[model samples]
Target: MSKPAKRKVILGMMAASLALTIGLNPQQADAAVDINASASILVDADSGKILFADNIDDQLPIASMTKMMSEYLILEAIDQGKISWDDEVSISDPVRTLSLQTELSNVPLRQDYSYTVKNLYQSMAIYSANASTIALAEHVAGSEADFVQMMNDKAGELGLESYNFVNSSGLNNSDLAGSHPEGTDANAENELSAKSVAQLAFHLINDYPEVLDTASIPELEFQAGEDETIQMQNWNWMIPGVNAGHEYEGADGLKTGFTSAAGNSFTGTALRDDMRLITVVMGAETRDDRFDETEKLLDYGFDNFHEAELLPEGYKPDGEDVIPVTGGKEKEVSISTSSALRSVIKNDEEELYVPEVSLASELLNEDGEFVAPLEEGQEVGQVQLTYEGEEDVEYLYDNQSSSTPLVADQAVEKASWFTMSMRGIGSFFSGIWTSVSDTVTGWF
Candidate 1:
């Protein structure tokens, strides 16, 4: 894929950051974006850190963005050999009914026609077609209801606590016209927090990057030269110079959603300089506001924050420092961190931070010495990174503020009683000999 147009924009921003280094301090350089969204969040796709958030946990209707889960399941089925891209999907009566509804966004299917999985995926990802999403759901799980259950199950597995999936496509329960699936309530609508949606976007992009292959197409032939041939264009306007008037440089796409119940919402991802950020905007005032707020959120992240490796992998803080064991075959046990520690910090303040390693209290007695029958790979403490000169460490720390575990590098087995007694006797005699030698020296 060609590089996003925002490469130049990001370079310029970096240059500006350098110039600001001469004029503004870190505190002055930090400026927050005020968005009109009812709920919004920006996340580092690589580190899963939240850079900016406003009412991020407030659950709201996500509209067609719910189709992201449907697309995920479809791609999974193909990967598992349960289905193939070329496999044909027969439209059901409900799917045909959805196709005819002028109120809903749909690909307009016919009962006599059969569409391939690839075709349906493209329609759902690019055009946000309601009928195509439901069709794919039914084909994959035998019913839209079962497919929705799968979506909910996946959400739970992902640790998503603030989401409820009522339908494969995000049509409101009322919009479904009492077509709500068997296990769901008649008035149910897919609901999730902006942060939860960002988490979903993170999983979607990382797990099924193949979704972008369909999402990036500005326009395509849905049926190619057939009587019902339809031209589809991506609704996401952030793609630089796409049909959407505002050209957001790195906006590749994820999904866009809107409905009467759920205001304009979007889950968008953009990449610049190998750094990808995901933004979720829910209940924006207008269609354009969703993209505009997303742009602000992305700019705030790219301009103010960065990801850095605080410590290298397999980092040993106290090299050759061993912890003493009370009863062990060995006198001491070795310790080290299992992996590198990564942190996100202000782009301009990366140099003023210091990392601290703290040993476990349980390993120490009153004199603060390690006492152990230590087990290998046992977690004994934590390594934390904090700013050196900053007055407000809390403001700078986030998910990246997390600690790496300090673990035992080697085990120390319990010692035998005879061995312990021999050492005790040797120490007593050595002390008596030292006292005699001191007295003889005094007489001389």
Candidate 2:
């Protein structure tokens, strides 16, 4: 058979296996087109599952969207109690120097000017103020160089495998801008993929939900203590949908960026009841195109897909049993899969099948007891789930199949046998020895 024919045959066999395992009614699966800028992605924020992706892994300059990491680390500092929103940050000479450069955005900050940390965050998130970013970085890390290090460190912690940062402000090249004449060294560009940006956006909203309040404000004017008030407008056009004269309900706050090299880029988020989705569009031809593409992607995600709760609450897998442990306080301990177990269901005519659960092997024990010092939520054994279509055959002679393993949630604990046996043996040996010695020496 030809390659296409062979693929179809294999798919059929795999579908059959899936149907038997998950008890799913056989249904057809359809593919969807990914629409966006050069590289785009839409994903379920809570699950980190990719709903749609176009050139997701390709790394590119993210432009002002790089501020997201800056904002994240700053907020994280606040959350850790290291910095407070009300804390006053003095504008240092370095910050003053950067603000003086006209090529970059600034709030006309002066040396010795003091602004609340909260206001700086507002400036960064609301207006994408480059000066505010530098001030906050300097305040937080003592220098922009140290703050960029923190940004890279946070990216690593987030598992952003294809991301890097060289500056808190997403300056393309300092040499080209000639912003810092004395410090005219060309700064390396910050990089991130569309998928990773989506993930980072999700982390911001999901983990530190309070940031949304600042980012979502439609407009705010910044006053620097008797200095001229600067009118700040939100960069995220989706908020209230005023950019294109179209209203998008449930549109929340996010960031947008543009640079000669990075092109027009955006990371937008929307919510429809319980289902929250994030969309990232990078490297668009024009500013308007980026907004239009992002709006379209958001619409597609909201209209075509929905959150399907696959496993009901408190639903445990079948055939789940107690796993034995050695050298612990208990002989065997029980574990159950705790995942909510859900998937994104497409709004198509074909019936969607359920995923089947499987186990890798039974639990094992060394000698009479299990391994010691088992912590809660530890995986003692493996379980897998296979997703497939339902088979048509009704009788036993029909073809059946298996699928790739989905890991089972396993919990481990101390085994009681080891604990009890050791205690008993120690007591018995001590008692006998003590009695014999006492009898021989008559020193009870």
Candidate 3:
């Protein structure tokens, strides 16, 4: 062929390859459902998949929902052995003063009164009690100042950039003019986006499931001393209503909060069968608006979205025949998946494209002898697939990766007599005599 003809042929092949690559990528689908909240989000708690989001990244005041961080930090303390449910907490003058003067939600703690950490946690989770929150923060960090720092640190670790913390309690501290007046610092505004709050709630429920148990209780009464026991009802109404029904049965406990500045806000979770979902709503006009919006979001999620397994469990890439070395009994080796393979899929009409499995070249040497001591299920290579028909795909069409052994597999026999003899002699010199006897006596 002429040089000009050859160049044209090469260009055509390159263009064909590029087109094929583009054809296989996965494309994002449009939002199939609409929600009523100003800012709302629904996510699969297990896969971190965003099933639906509306202005989810917009930052908004979370009101007493800030207690979620308080809950997480406290649980982390319990996990780290810093505090326990049985630990006793005493209400200091600061706690008492905050409890008495603040019109904010509180557990009505009295001066010098002691309560268990468990009760304090219940107060914060169920009632969004600012006083109990401050007390718990002080107990965990020795001071509210330190606790706020810890909260900010955790937010950073969780990649929450829209959030900032000024106090253990979520009270707007800036308006007080009295001697012990509350004030909000510029940093204390403690803003977070709906998506970020949803992320935080997911982590809390997924990691510490006990939180739902405490938060879901509709009513509880406790006392500080000779004073009458106060009845505390869960502010999140969904727990007693729709969530209590079989349709919303997986509904777990979460928090609700409202302030003039923060408006109505809620973070809720529900698990239906194997599917777990987290919904966050913020910036509602009325106290009940947050819960209503959250319910709508969760309803849309459970009604429309479903957990679908894309790949069969235990599906794996097959390994090519590997050559055995020297005197090994087996001449070739192969590998397979040690466990099931699977992926979460949407219930929508869009189907998950089948994955393509690819393996590396067969293991062999220049002499054509098989490599001995081949490990079973060793990741010889990868498998990948591209969607058959898709446009404007963001991610690659095919997923390709290496395989790994579910369990450890090693060679029990040596490949060559020379290699086995060397190992035997080394073992004998090292005071391991059995292997040496076997190797030497085997020659006979």
Candidate 4:
């Protein structure tokens, strides 16, 4: 056979061996999901799995979805001791002015009224109150303008690419005092892609889960038990059983938004059967359409996708390959994965998973064997577990796919020639003695 043909045969046999050893088989993979919204995405909040997405990267006016970041920064302030939930925040003029704007949502902040930071949080999170969000922004960062800078800075820190905040409230009013004033067109609005929104939501829920306690409130009187109280309602109607207009089961607290330029947008989260999903919908035609489309997005995720713990943190991979030492005390050292690997997988597609093992090709000498003077826990290689699909019949969510490091399982020191020669001489002498004893016993 030609050399190329012989190599092909060898490679085919190795692939077959890997499949049988890993219990993988040829099978269909996950199907793509289509959503009705202009831009949308559904992700596993814990694993950051993109179960479904439609134009998720197209930056559009995300309306009140911008509040997710506002809320995140406010919550972060509370966590870092820069502010306290119990601390009273004096309402600022910009916030008071926002209260008078009938076109925007407001919790009716009064400049003279002293409200607890907690009250402001509830109003902003549950009601999507523009005034309360700005009030909290001003109180936390000295001015609303400065607060917008913090929001943008935080977005950069989170590695978000498609977000620009002209205002903390997600309002698209050119009249507002900000650098990126609301434009006559969509570009002027606070913009982000559905994918970026999902990531922001992911950071929000993961870093400060306590914010959910505020977001999930169906209804609360702002400053309840105070002498003067304002009725506040969660604008997110998809709050499970809380909002009668659309009570999605497993739904929880999030924010909603709509503007003449941005249309309707929502960032929602839900949990069912130990799995939490984050959904983002932008530019839905109507108020109800946002909730309806989000419901469909969430349903598609919970139905089609399933979470599977592929490998626990600190899990060692099976059949860890040994690294041969060139000149070491030990001839070889074993290697394994240094971290855990988990994912949200498609149901019934477990058989199609291909765990591709690889080592740093440079670690191999011309003999195609690992040359080692290796230390324990040294990083040597990597193993990536993926599903087969159109990109090879893949079923695994891209974000949640496992890429684990292969580390040295044991230390291998360089072997010395003197030690090798001594061992060989000892073995030869021992064999000679054994043979001499056997012959003497036979003669006797």
Candidate 5:
């Protein structure tokens, strides 16, 4: 693009501060929820802002959903050069044995043989294969115990509110053939809050979107041409025509879990009409109930919420639109939001949001004056929306922050030496005249 065109595009962004107008037009605190799970939540995938929540903080068993964390660490290992998708991984006896289990296993394993990390990861994500999950975890961290430690540490790092990782596979230790992670009890299983699981799913897709490529696959063969190959089906039926002929529109990925104690759970995400939503269902009574509840959340979100550009480009806060410019040719520089502020909000809640601005302290002095030589679009600080009404608001990621850079709308060049000298002289005389007038007033 040409320079002018680029500038025009850049200038089209507006940093807006959200100031919730309370009582005047209160938003429905619980408009989009009518779920029957022990814990459930719906969030805007991009903003991490909750649209509906119920018992979201209740910690519950996650079952194979526990693989979500292992998925994250495995993906991280690949990203950090610690491992590669094609690297061969060792298969322990316990993994091989568990893969042979009658009820909870998929994609049979042969410990004497070898499998690539990609092969195991695909099986883990698409099939929620217990043995494949353990294999990837072991490959990434050398042991399921150590991998469990990594899972808990990463949960803490991700600001998960309620989480406990006993193993990488999210299976009960009793199912591990007495070979569960070192420190966990024989009956222990992975657990997380609905919010926490949503948080994990949030980072999983945001950090390694490629996981969806496999997670979305309806079915695949673990060993395409090998005799020991097993056909795997993704438990996440939300994927289009993935299972039971049930599908949700825009459904692409996420994770699913089931265990007697954990019941049924799903971390499902979908995208449609430029608005993506993530839903979590925990402790559901039936496998199909989880998907039904997820569909309920997705339907409400898509039907009620929209991506609203609340602040238009060139929008400036009511009283915080200009920055004092010291040493610049102009006394003050006009500023605007660096980008248009958009949020997934319910249709009736737009009037409740207002824009506010804040500046970087280092860039400005106590009197709110910035030094000269600022380029157009030079970022200064940020604008954030604050809600004071009854509804609770939170971002899924712990470190998720308000965006839209507060910037200088126009360039400001330093004043010439001649201009500086003249201004200094004028100030000197003006100060003397003020002092003389004060003295005369006191005498009178």
Candidate 6:
């Protein structure tokens, strides 16, 4: 990706940092993007590090965005051989009624006809078809109620908190014609925090990258070249060619949603400069506002932050460069980082990273020293990165810091008894000679 014209200016002030000669640091860039929404977040998709966050943990109605969880389960079922893309899913009475309502997002269906799992998935993913989603869910789990349970269980397994899935399609329970999943309030709707939503999207794309192949499609034919076909346009208008006026350079996916309770919301991911960022905005007042707010976030991520080396290969923390080895030919073995530590960092905050060393106790002797016969490239411990900046970073995964291995740089053999005796004798003569020389110099 070509660097935006402003990139030169962003890095122009970094010259002075070069003189530090210790480590590379990012220079502060333009002010952070001001998002207009109830909750929003920006995250590096790879490392899961949160670059920006605003009320990200507040649960709010997410509407159709809830389908991400359903999509995940569907892909997982296919992966596990429990279901296949070519498998036919027969529409049930409730699903057929829902599809025919025309008031909700859907593809019309007849009870006598069946649709392939792949087609229903595409309709749900690209078109946000509510009834298509329900059919797919029922096909996967035998019933919509069971599918909702799977969604919640998968949420728990994915470490998603502040979330609830009442239905597979994300329609308000009332919209389900009182046929909502069991135990849910009639008016209940699926809800999730921007953070949790981003996490779900993160897992979805990573676990099943092929989702993007379908998500990036601007439009598709529900049943192309058939007697009954519905052309569906992706709700995500930011996609290239979908809306030339609103296209973001790298915007590809992931989903857009809206409901009376849940304002316009979007979760989008883009790839540029070898970095993929996920942005979530909820409660936007207008359809354009969600896309506009998403642009600010994507711009902020691309302009103000980048992937940088936190610690270079062979990095050795201060005063922890060597490990003492008892009874070894060498008294100590040199140690250094076994691998490079890299992560997404905000511009102008590069110096805030500090490398910390942690040792593995199992590899230590009674004296807390390395035993004889240390092997080269032997991993003795791990080195991890920690940010010292005032701002706290929230990772999409477990919010854990990045880490690398710490290993011995060279081998250290055990000293033989004969070698130890010879070394002792040599030391005794060396000490005597040094004392004689000191006495002669004093007499002079």
**Winning candidate number (lDDT):** 6
Off by over 4 Å in 6: 1-32, 326-332, 371-378, 397-399, 409-444
TM-scores across all candidates?
Answer: 0.77, 0.71, 0.71, 0.77, 0.87, 0.82
Best by TM-score: 5
* lDDT to native, each model: 0.80, 0.70, 0.67, 0.76, 0.84, 0.88
Residue lDDT tens for model 6, 44-84: 99889888888888899999999999999999999999999
Task: In angstroms, give how far residue 209 of model 1 lies from its true place.
Answer: 3.2
| Candidate 1: C-alpha RMSD after superposition | 9.5
State in Å the error of residue 237, model 4.
1.8
> lDDT by residue for model 5 over 1-444, one digit each (tens)?
999998876665422112333332233334445687899989898989888777888889999889889989988999999999899988888888788874885678886677999988988898888888888888888888899999999999888889999998878889887899999999998888999999898888888988889889998877823566677888899898676555988999899898888998899999999888999999899989999989889988898889988787677877778778999899898888867888887677777776667788887877779988888998887887665445656677655644577789999999999999999999999999999999999999
Query: Residues 306-341, candidate 1, lDDT per residue (tens digit)?
Result: 777777767776553466667567877767778888
- By lDDT, rank the candidates, best first: 6, 5, 1, 4, 2, 3
What is the Å distance of residue 79 in model 1 from its true position? 4.0
Q: Lowest summed-lDDT stretch of 10 residues in model 3? A: 393-402
List the lowest-lDDT window of 10 residues for candidate 2: 393-402
Question: For residues 1-444, could you state the per-residue lDDT of candidate 4 as single tens digits?
Answer: 999999999999999887674454322122224455688777788877666666777888888889989889988888899999899988766667767674677767776667898888888888788878777888888876788788889998987868888778888756454423223233466888777888888889999998888788888877533365777778889875466878988888687888876788888999988889988888888888888888887777788778776665555657656656665687677777787766677676666666777788887788756775778888888888767753233211344445678888888776678987887899899999999999999998
Supply candidate 1's per-residue lDDT for 104: 81
RMSD of each candidate relative to the true structure = 9.5, 11.7, 11.4, 10.4, 11.9, 8.4
- If both were scored by lDDT, which would come out higher, candidate 1 or candidate 2? 1
